[model samples]
Target: MTRSTGVVVIGGGQSGLAAGYHLRRSGIEHVILDAQTAPGGAWQHTWESLRLFSPAAYSSLPGRFMPAQDGQVYPDAAHAVSYLADYEKRYELPVQRGVRVSAVRRDGGHLRVETDSGDWRARAVISATGTWTRPFLPAVPGRRDFRGRQLHTVQYVSPAEFVGRRVIVVGGGNSGAQIAADLAHAGTDLTWVTQRPPRYLPDDIDGRALFDAATARRKALDAGSTDTGGVAHLGDIVAVPPVRAARDAGLLHAKPMFTRLTPTGAEWADGTTVEVDAVMWCTGFRPALAHLAALRLRGARGHIATVGTRAVDEPRLHLLGYGDWTGPASATLIGVGRPARDAAREIAGLLGS
Candidate 1:
């Protein structure tokens, strides 16, 4: 079956929801296509111990503020899930769950979104399928030869199974630091590994500050100014409560990334080695854009070149919430709103709605 809509939103997660909210506000008829059977997007898949970098109030979508979590300075994964699920219901966004988009192709003057359930003919398509599905694990020589258990951030639920195991956590990003802290708190024999020394944001700095800085940078760039002081001058990881506590306790120290993996452990270039029972890869993810492959929009940098949120090659398509390329910090709950609103406005303008 084929359905028609003014706009088609792929992925009903935070980015998709943000776009939906703005599109709805703009009086655009749209359908949100979500591969998941439920709401909450990537938040639902994160580990149980995961916490937001800021308070619930700061980490929210466009129209509504997330309610504070009881006695928690930073909300947990469950709280985020609850908020996202409720947001979908409260907004009455036209979300079709369990509908996985396979490919999108040009259909005359419209875009044809192919899915397992059906196809959609949309005047404009917003690809908001964020990076969660494409968890990245770097290829190190002898990685395949490792006999111990290996897991990615996406597959991890909690530290229950790994409580007593000797684990090596790799990656220098927030996920790596956060997961390492979770394992350390669980009393696991943990070895945190990074390509370089981990850089942490100030204790007072959080998502809000980062977003503000990004906004300033965007404004500066818009004004044709070169001095855009942004997050680049700051640290990589946010010092959330848990991460801060872990760092204070001297538990989150990281080792240099190993040169290769052996049968039972990792080996460093300096001939140092650690025998670990498991390897936890918190590397990160690339944008989940395989569905748009048929459109052939990806460029040499492995991303579709864009002017703001709209694809340069295909103005009929907009990419949301992938990262800074779409908008300044558009991956975050609060950050995605601006780009989403702008995208909706552009679509409405194009459609003469």
Candidate 2:
């Protein structure tokens, strides 16, 4: 059976929630399809120690502010999940959970959303399925032959399992720093490997500051003014309390990237080898857009070209929460609002509503 709506939102994560909020405020009827059985989206899958760089009050969606926790300066994964679940109910957004989208194909004047549950026809579609499900691991030789356990950020729950074992955590981003810290705190014999020296933001700076910078850059771009540098110049790795303490204690010293993996461990180009019991890849993730493959919209970079959130090839389709390409810092909880609002407005206009 084919049902109809003004819009269909894919993936009910933070981005999807923001899009839903704006679409509701615009008085546009839409339904959000989420693969997760419950609320919280990717937060549900994050490691127990994962903490947002900002406080609850600083990270929020379009209509509601995430309420601050009783004692946490920076909310943990659970708090984020709770906030999203409540936000969905508070707005009474029409979100259909446990519905996995299979494909999105053009169907005359509307787009057809094919899912395991059924099909829906909509004048527009918003893809907000974020990157959690698509954890990325670089192709290092001998990875498959490694005798030790390998894990990615998406699969990692805690450092408990790696305690008392030799482990190498790869990647230079926030995840790598945090996980390396977590392991060190747990007394794991750990080596942090990175492609280059890790860059840490000023101790006082946080996600809010980054978002503000991104906002300034976006505004400057809209005005056709000089590039404001945005968050690019600010540095990587936010020094949250844990990461800061870990680094201060010399527990987070990083090793240069290894040339390849050995059956027992990693080997550098200089022939130095370190044997380890496990390797943790905190590399990152690609956008979860496999369901859109049938549309044939991906460019050479494996991304759909976009002007703001609207896809250049198909204006009826807008992507949210992927990253800067969709909107500056749009992947962050607080930064997605502007792009979501713009996408909703553009979608409404396209629908002539």
Candidate 3:
């Protein structure tokens, strides 16, 4: 039996929850299908000590404000997960967890979504799975032969696991910098290897303001306008404070890009070698669009093409939390809500509500 809904949301994370909330507010019937056992998407699987670099004020969803003390740093991953759970309950969003969507295709004039549990037919669908679906580990030679435990930053939970081991963290992004600092303080012998030294940002700019200038610049770029020569033209895309702290703490090393992994350790492009007990790859993630193979995606760099936020080919298909449409803010908690609300309004109009 095919379970039918007015609209089917593909993810139950912040974006999906926001979409569901907006749809419900408009009195539209919809159901959210998520692969996880509960809400909070990737937050549920993030490292134990991870915290938002943005303040609580910037981390809110559509209708709720993040509960936090004044001047306090952003919520950690656990706190974020708890907040998302509460958001779901408060809005009474219709979500079906543990239903991994395997495929999505257009059936006649409607959308057909096939999942592990069953099939759902709906008038529209929103892909809010976020950008971190697949961890992108570079194809370094000899990685299979590495004897030490090599893991992605996604699998890292606590520094205690590497307390007595020599750990090498690869990458210069926020994750790499933060993990290096944590492990170094945890008494683990650590080395942070990065090809490009990151441009760090101050934890608090003037008057304790979180640095959101990057997001604004990205939005301008996406809108086909060049950045004005101002504060935005100051530095690299990665923030500066964490990187500076990591370097000051003796955790960062400007190494060549990873060339390969040997049974003993890793080799860099510059032929330098580092022997260690573990390797933590903090490399970024790629969009998981394998399930959308049936949809003819027309975009550069393997992304689905959109004309001003709506899919060019699929009318009812819209992308949320994608940096392509709304800019870098699309990926952050603070940035996703407004676009999600806009998408919900568009979806409601399409449903003739």
* Top lDDT prediction, candidate number: 2
Worst 10 residues of 3 by lDDT: 202-211
What TM-score number comes out for model 1? Answer: 0.97
Q: Over all chains combined, what TM-score does candidate 2 have? A: 0.98
Sort by lDDT, best first: what order?
2, 1, 3
TM-score of 3: 0.89
Model 1: runs farther than 4 Å from truth? 227-229
lDDT of 2 by residue, 254-318 (tens): 98999999999999999999999999999999999999999999988886999999999999999
For model 3, residues 223-318, the per-residue Cα lDDT tens digits are 789874323344332333444556677766556566788899877767888889998999888876677788878566676776544677897887
Per-prediction TM-score: 0.97, 0.98, 0.89
* Candidate 1 displacement at residue 112 in angstroms: 0.7
The regions of model 3 sitting more than 4 angstroms off are: 69-72, 205-215, 227-247, 298-300, 326-328
Please report how far candidate 1 places residue 251 from its true position, in Å: 1.5
Separate clash counts for every candidate: 0, 0, 6
* Candidate 1 global CA lDDT score: 0.92
